[model samples]
Target chain A: MSNGIRVAALEDIPEGEGIVIDKSVTGTADDIALLRDTDGSVWALDDTCTHEDASLAEGWVEDGYVECPLHASRFCLKSGEVQNLPATRSTCPHRVEVRDGEVYLFPNETP
Target chain B: MDADISRVVVVGGGIAGVSTVAALRAGGFDGDLTLVDTGEFPYDRPPLSKEYLAGRRDLKQIALRTPQWYDQQDVRLVNLTAVTALRPAEGAVELAGGRLLPADRVVLATGGGAARPPIPGSDGERVHVLREAEDADRLRTVLVPGARLLVVGAGLIGAEVASTAVDLGCEVVLADPVNPPLAAAVGIDLAAWLHGQHAARGIAVVPAGVESFEPTAAGIAARFSSGHEPRVFDAAVLGVGMVPQTALAVAAGLETERGIVVDTCQVTSNPAVLAVGDSARTRRDGLLLPRTEHWEAAQQDAARAAATLLGRPAPPATAPWFWTDRHGRHVEAVGRMAEADQVVIRGSFDDPAFSVFGLRAGLVVAAAAVDDPTAVRAARRMIDRRVRIDPARLEDPSVNLRALLR
Candidate 1:
């Protein structure tokens, strides 16, 4: 009955790290990557890298971008714009908000 | 001679060639640029042995650039055309059917073909080599479940094919002279683990070189150099190495040893011509460096070649990096492991993620990881930035890699 699924507490995600919201829970076609940048800002994007089947949730988050773990393709966490290749297509950005101390995920919605 | 160049022709459509064109356009080179390729479209080759062979990705999905990219970049797409000759004296490129195209400069990005060793009876119809998309397609048809397969050379390509074949339910026999290959590139420990994984996953690992092949009524029989009895296989694949495609350069009277010799700027012996990718080998200070046949190496060559042609400072060199994926495990290595005097591993080999760091004189020289690309990425930065690090901290799994950068 809720559009925003309360996934975790704000403290659940480490700074400059990402956690995956499985596809079944998010009700999306793919898993979602909830990234916490070094600046303490939270962002969400489809976890599956557009270039391949690699999970972006496992990528290295730094400087407002997430570098794919399999390949070094960096994606802008804010806009999901690909900053490099072997990945040319941008991942899908998602909307996220913090309510009280909980993080809410809006599936298939842009921030 | 202030770079009044206008028309340019690039031969080959591999990663090196595409990257060259992309880099040229990115660097504001508005000259008349043309890409002459032998394929219908430029596609990435790494997937040929993995995804494409597994029938997971098709030709279009593996394309390096889209159809709209050529038009957007204003690059003339001369598909299915091969440059027959490089007439540097007249600044012209001759194509098949005797058409001469005027060019101010020529970039030779022709990639290499798979090495076909002189093994007796190797030319049989059952013998195969994977290089082009067509080759992958042909290999795929025989990869049916339970088909007996003999893959020679336990290197990257051979191991990858063996892993893929096993996944497809094919009976895979992997043979190589070396007990565990890739030691110099990824260090000894990781190499052993990677090589040993084949046997644990339903693959027959043989420590012997192939002697010859004999076609029998039942598939093909292969004799081993170890004096083992002849084994029958439905098919066999050669994954030894690559032979540089330097015929055009040789016939054109350019300097070629193992590959086309180029200077710091990727300019070939002929000033009017340049070579990049596997077909190009760099000669610096009268020293010829070995040809790097990896995907990233080719891409890196593109950036350097563009800068050289545009008269801009070449991008600062970084630690060389490469990657391979097999058995659902992703492996990455940076720099040269052979340069290390000490090797320290982060986390256990059985862990989901582990990295081996190669250190020399308290400096991180190289690193290889199993499903831990972050560690390799951090290692690459440490190597490039020349950051001094303590091996103890690097080995501690609890220490975040970012702290090591300091």
Candidate 2:
């Protein structure tokens, strides 16, 4: 059995923006960001930046990369690869699938 | 392309050192990495002056990386081992423990040490200079509520400590030789405004140089050059400044000015050695930025230096950036304002959020935003591209700085 959970609705998150979904899967304060790219593609990643303890939900998303609001470190929303300095570690990329206009997240393995 | 670049030695286990090691691993550099430090562990330094002093944060939370993370990253941690000298000719460092670690490449991230004033009795138990984690831990126990805290120097650290003391309900007195804080970095007008802001917060801003401090039964008494006005205080904090640890670089025959002189790639005079963080004095377009002590600058410099070591072209230097938090208010600034000819103010001064733009030769060279992250973000981009916006538009609070970049 897969340990996946329904996080948010597609309508709740607009296109070309990110919405932070708070969940209790992780003992720590875990926040997941649902981002919609310019090409209408959606991606999910951990809201806490791996470099510093900054919130990625406050970051600016553009061209499939979410720039950390604190230091402007860019991270690829899909692969979670940190594209810039200051933040060299990649954020935990969550597996997301749209089922009946609702987004379900698999919180176990981070890509 | 890998031409035998294996061993990488990082000196100094502060934020810059740990970040360098992490960045190298993340950048796909599978080298024999060794991190040497005099300190027991890698910890955050910024909090030493603020949260740590206020007894709000514990030592465990400030550790940059857990011991397990170092092992997982394949990093060799040499703790409590001080590097006495650097032999750049042989690409090796001499540790005080009588060990020589040879490396294909070396990174000097030794950071900076606190600068103590020449005044007598400056090193007493009642007086303290904050730099390391232990320093803050020891100082926090003494900075009790209702204590008379006399803080010398009005720089970023000085001001932050003063603000923290005030928040803790301590009687804080701020003294500096200069009339206004940051007058040397920022202009007099801005510094004066900052002084006024601090004064409004009920802190006594004493504009006098310290002659000496005498220990009394109640506390320490600070004597200033302007007629000795003795004030008993439970504790005193010295946040004067920092001196770059460039002794190793100088001993290794590296070019030294105010700090270890480095190029855009953060490469010291010796091509095999690089300096990053506060210890590096990088030159850009003939201007020497001796002390870009901000955390962001250290991270960027470390990344650039790493790229240079890997034989990659480094990115162009962006505008200088720095931020400070005082009395729950966040102040962020970008670029060098010392060279600006025109100053533009946006938003009402009475409002909590406002900004000042510094323009030189019609270009937005620098900006300082108070409680205004939006304006700061815009100013960062404008400074990065060296873009010139209309002075009137810059002064208008409604004008989005981001649109100006567009």
Residue-wise C-alpha lDDT for candidate 2, range B294-386, written one tens digit per residue: 787887887787787677777677887777777777777788888889989898667868888889989888888777755767777788887
Maximum-TM-score candidate: 1
In model 2 chain B, the worst 10-residue window by lDDT is B183-192
Q: Which stretches of candidate 2 lie over 4 Å from their true place?
A: A1-58, A67-111, B184-189, B283-289
Weakest ten-residue segment in model 1 chain A by summed lDDT: A1-10
Q: For candidate 2, what is the lDDT? A: 0.80
Candidate 1 CAPRI level: medium
Give the alpha-carbon lDDT of every model.
Answer: 0.91, 0.80
Worst 10 residues of 1 chain B by lDDT: B1-10
Best by lDDT: 1
Over all chains combined, what TM-score does candidate 2 have? 0.85
Candidate 1: tens digits of C-alpha lDDT, residues B1-406: 1276788888999999999999999988999999999999999998998999999999999898889989999999899998999998999999998999998889999999999999999999999999999999999999999999999999999999998999899999999989789999999889999998999898988899999999999899999997867799999999999999999999999999999999988999998899999999999999999999989888888888888878899898888899998988999999999999999999998876899999999999999999899899899989999999989999999998976764
Q: Which is the leading candidate under DockQ?
A: 1
